[model samples]
Target: MQDHQSGHQRLTLSDVQRPEYLANPYPLYHRLREHDPIYWDEEMHAWVLTRYTDVVAVLRDPRFSSAWGPVETAWMPEELRPQLEPALRAVSRQMLFLDPPDHSRLRGLVARAFTPRMVESLRPRVQRLVDELLDAVQDQGEMEFVADFAYPLPAIVIAEMLGVPPEDRSQFIVWTQDFGRLLDGGHLSFEELLTTLSGIADFLAYFRRQIAQRRTAPRDDLLQALILAEEQGDRLNEEELLGNCVLLLAAGHGTTTHLLGNGLYALLQHPEQLQLLRENPSLAPTAVMELLRYDSPVQLTSRRLTADVEWAGRRFKAGEEVLTVLGAANHDPEQFPDPDRLDLRRTDNRHVAFGHGPHFCLGAPLARLEAEVAFTTILRRLPQLCLATEQIERLPSLVFRGIKALPVTFASVLPATGATAAAED
Candidate 1:
């Protein structure tokens, strides 16, 4: 275990990558927030903001740009820069990486399909999927939570929404895993970069074919809606359409998978909280919110300063990069009372688990719905569920926090005759 305070008074980004920190980063975040709330990380070539106030301020500030084209290639090796062009181009068009008017334009076109009402309409389908997934392992008495339950629910939901063939849903796991690596604060090795780019290439190609098919024969799906979406004669171009579709697919499932894994792990650790939730399933909404605050799936987000500014007692120049530590902000003691404790009933919880301001997560409602359904159904169906092993592995990424796999045991229940029947009722 590395000492939280050793010789140096200030913590660096390398300290964040320590094995212990990766498993549980809140302690490290506490140290960072306490000692250097707005510190410059020499390794990352960016300012790291850990305080809740600072994170919220930066996120809502218009001066900080989300555009990635200028920021992505800044740290790349000169030789590899050319190799990264295609990947960068694809990312530049993504709503996640763009700022208005592009961000506004793209989001306006896609927001209709993800509105609260629209997402709520997905509850029945999500519930059915959750029940079916649990039904598959209900007889096993044990299962890997991530593979058995967490990953598939949202993945299948998003795939079906995009009109992706059911058979093609499995391939997204590989593509998303590869794409997620690129967001891990650029710690990729030479080989890893190539693999990520290849995976992205394949993802785009696959979607290109889908888009072409939608063009020829329209369907009543989100993808086709995007294809036909027009705002005052403005429409998504080929690159924008491809980039956003891939973004939706990856972002849709990846964060939710982590949320479920992290949320369940947190609950299992705090058995009292788990039991509290079990006794009062009505707490599902607040419980999910608390879980998000306790250990956010997307830990960090970056922004580029558009102009020189003095804030948080520091001067930031135009074009300087800033990394807002969302996970840390979510755990800030000032904002969240008993920040580390798992309280299913925590209220007025305005955690940035889905972010804030214009760039807040588009799929938040869908993710929350999926989680609410999954947690409620899992507790109801699987009696006496408990961790099968204390040993657990976390995904190797700083920006995204998640369990690689969670094995658990439960008293097996008889399989349901009809998974959707209860949902319909």
Candidate 2:
């Protein structure tokens, strides 16, 4: 309701591109929300869309494009352009990062593997994985929740879906960790960015080898479905296959890992809610939704204006950079009252954590199921669980907010009866 253009045009890049803001963006977000909700940054030569509604509108708006660069012009810095040109060229083929028609096509091709029935069919399997993970954590007095529980739940689920062998999960851990590091806009040095690009090359090499094997000898898994997916003689090209694989690995793993880690951290911080959850196991379904809304894992997404557009009495030029702050949008007072408070019992909570419109996450059901199983199993089995470390360390990426390590200590070996108990020794 407040739009004042007179004094706001003096905004500089330092205002939004500060390292301190990355550490705790909410304060800067508050300032921006109050003064200039949609301001342009000169340093990055881009516009920033911060207000909750504005961010959501941009994400759902087709006039604002998802495919920003890396097509004829990759977005990488000029210094490393020579080294990364090949890999950066493939970035445009990714489904989440692509535009309509292509985005819709690639998303649809993979949608069959993630249909509701397929996700539901795996519930029992997911429950088993959660049980096994929780049982291992229960035998120890202390555990790093992220490593011991959070990271593995979704990593395993994604691996199973992609037909990755159990032993190869370590590869995914390395790839995902490196991928996360390269995304740190505030902290990623040139060397680290190149390292991530190198890792991508390695992953592509591995995927190519695997694709060859899968193509010759198909299996009953998602990878096989991808390999065989053909519509009127249309199939994924080599670059598209590799790009989608990277997309799946990056999107599928990071979000779910943070979802579990962020959710459990919230529960531990709020003991009353933890106790309530321990008392009612059936509340897992509702609790997962609250967890997503309270502390969304993926904080922001980027877009570029394909054409000049006006909204809320402000005009944006074409080819401008727009950052949709999902974290802030999820906490907007206009949309969610007491946006700072976490309400597990709230009935009418509609959040844009997974995004909105055409960009809504395709893996929502699977991620939800995994979190439900992971959190319920952790809380139910380890009632004595409490933080072993006073201050948990978060991952260094601004785009993804998750604990790098969550040191938790428990009173005893609270193993669920009849469940296999494997010590974390």
Candidate 3:
């Protein structure tokens, strides 16, 4: 990729998905902050807000909509909706795309299952799962972390949490990668769009079956809880129930999967921090914050104006959109000191990698718990861990960022059984 500069407008639309930008977007983000803080891009046709303060405001402001009306159908434009009504019904039920009474109600119901006690209760399970994943590859002395470990940890946890059968988890991975294109598909062709929608159709059908079984004989899992959840005379309708299950699976799985992959890559790049973390694996929780800030998995999210108005000293009309570059804000020098350096013990980390305000990720505590368990188990079990190869492929999407695979070599050791299980927290 060649660098070009033009009259204080040094960034270009092409830079958004360039290999160099994907590999190290922070430098480009820094350049944007210096040259054009709230610049508009002709490619996306959306205003790009890079400053941390400006980004947070849009995330919190009610005027900026999730614009979920289109999400119901995998974000198919108006022309395509008629042929894709099934998908529209399913995803619209997801809470990530909801607002007001619906978002509040769905969040209130799901919150019960994701509380501190609830998340803590699963720590042992998470630990055991991590150990099991490592045990499978412990003797190999090398493994692809993303495929072997990172991708499965939260996926299995969330699948079981929602009553998805163990045998079904593999299919979940395939479905997730396809359905996730709803948000960020850069210049996707019509054929590619249809392929994604077909996946969404399959996902809705799979969950519908599980949801039906729960209806007949409700289990004591998160999906059943969601089915039975009620709030202040409000209950999730059928569409709401199924759509949210779709939402939870996507939201619950994607972020943490990338966290481990992205976080481990960050650690491998910064040996000092890796050494510090290996020395005190208990520091994994705090370290997760810096990992999120350093290379956020969800790179950027957008909000559309609900009413014509001026914000951040700029004028905007209703229906316009503002894209918040979280990776850039996480690297904002004004908010974080030495923003580019990976500091494992940084205490002032308040990055919005999981987002902020009303739509703040409901599954944050669970993601954190899963990471803590994954890092500690990996560091404790795999000694002398080092990257097998420096070359890694990252998903080339506008909204999501993650490695496709991470090969690493580590000293082999006898598999250690998890300490006598602690009574549930």
Candidate 4:
């Protein structure tokens, strides 16, 4: 509930959802951390948690269930559940929304198929994609960083990783944008809900068709490997397979794109941090970690109580919603000294940007790799890069924080690099 005390200002998450706050919500996060770390809000009908310790506790505790309630009505508005039964099940079965045994089962197979080895192998490919993306705008001297670099870099990586056809990558990008709304919108508006439904339907059809084809003619990709993940005479059901595939497609790309976009934007905003990284290339990894903490891509995640539990001197009943303000937690003073400052060399950082415990993002390593590669390449290659416009549009998403477009200009370094190279001469 909104606090309307006369002559005394107070705020809530809804206040943080506006355009002004979206652009810069860290201050509000700071306020939450200092004032109401475990606030009960009537509007959200959830315990709004802002402290690092509390957010981590909720995330790691087994008392909290990630499973969505009633699969049929989970994906869309209550009224639309009848028509979207199949689509709802597909979404509801995703490991992101499951708990314990089911979560462990799906995660085991995915972890096996998408190991750190696989991510390490993509380093060269990710670098090439970054180069190619930058090369496309090398002559223009200006480009929309989000559309040109950030979006395409991760989109291409995820597409190739999933065995999505080279030609079909464009459509896959469109589908991914639609799916991102499922998480980012909180509760979707009618039009947005319809778009999400349509996206899920298309994805279900495509995943099923692809799974069927892969069974007939297996490919050497993550999807194929997942389809083949057989354990103790067990395997993914059609529903599980479809759900996880769609989950991978949606999660695999969108978060990384936002990371790239938000990380870049954060650097631009704090030129000193950008300068530090540019001068010291070895700091790339730490810089990425700092960026994730500085301006996290995924800002909020939720959990439901499975049983009544007492936490932080408060009682929360079973099945109650707990809203973890990840962005706020990342900036909690208790967790990080000088929480507002952008320190690329931030060492004690344990930000919950990717959450924590069982449901932590599987693609965290890959996202980190992409950010490091992207940041390193951009700094090394485009030394003259600068923002073309001060106007940066944050994504219309509560969960995902990213710029709509980061217009930028840099000196064309193509001729020098090209002129220095002579093919077999």
Model number with the top lDDT: 1
Residue range 104-124, candidate 4, lDDT tens digits: 988988886457898887887
* Model 4 misplacement above 4 A: 1-10, 73-83, 230-233, 414-425
How do the residues 1-425 of candidate 1 rate in per-residue lDDT, one tens digit apiece? Answer: 12234465547755667789877888988887887788888777888889999999999898999887553566556776665655667767899988888899899988998999999988888887877788788778999999888998888999999898867878999989887887777677877787787788788889889988877888899898887763224567766887888899999999999999999999899989989998999999999998999999998999999999999678999999999999999999999898988889999899999999999999999999898888877887888899999989887777888998999999885555464685667
Q: Which regions of candidate 3 deviate over 4 angstroms?
A: 1-10, 70-83, 230-234, 417-425
Please give, for residues 137-186, the per-residue lDDT of candidate 2 as tens digits.
Answer: 56567888888778877888888899877668778878777656655445
| Per-prediction TM-score | 0.93, 0.88, 0.93, 0.92
Error of 1 at 242 (Å): 0.3
Instruction: Provide the overall lDDT of each model, using Cα atoms, as 2-decimal numbers.
Output: 0.85, 0.74, 0.81, 0.81
TM-score of model number 2: 0.88
TM-score of candidate 1 on Cα atoms, chains taken together: 0.93
Q: Per-residue lDDT tens digits of candidate 3, residues 1-425?
A: 12336665557544868988877777888877787788676667778888999999889989888756654445567776764676766676677777877788778888988899999989888877887888899779999898889988888999888889766778888778876787773676878877877788788888888877877886888888877753223577777777788888877888899989999998888888888998997788899988988899888888888888777667777888788888889999999999988998999999999888898888889998998878876877788899999799888878887899999999894566435144222
Per-candidate alpha-carbon RMSD to the true structure = 3.3, 4.3, 3.3, 3.3
- Sort by lDDT, best first: 1, 3, 4, 2
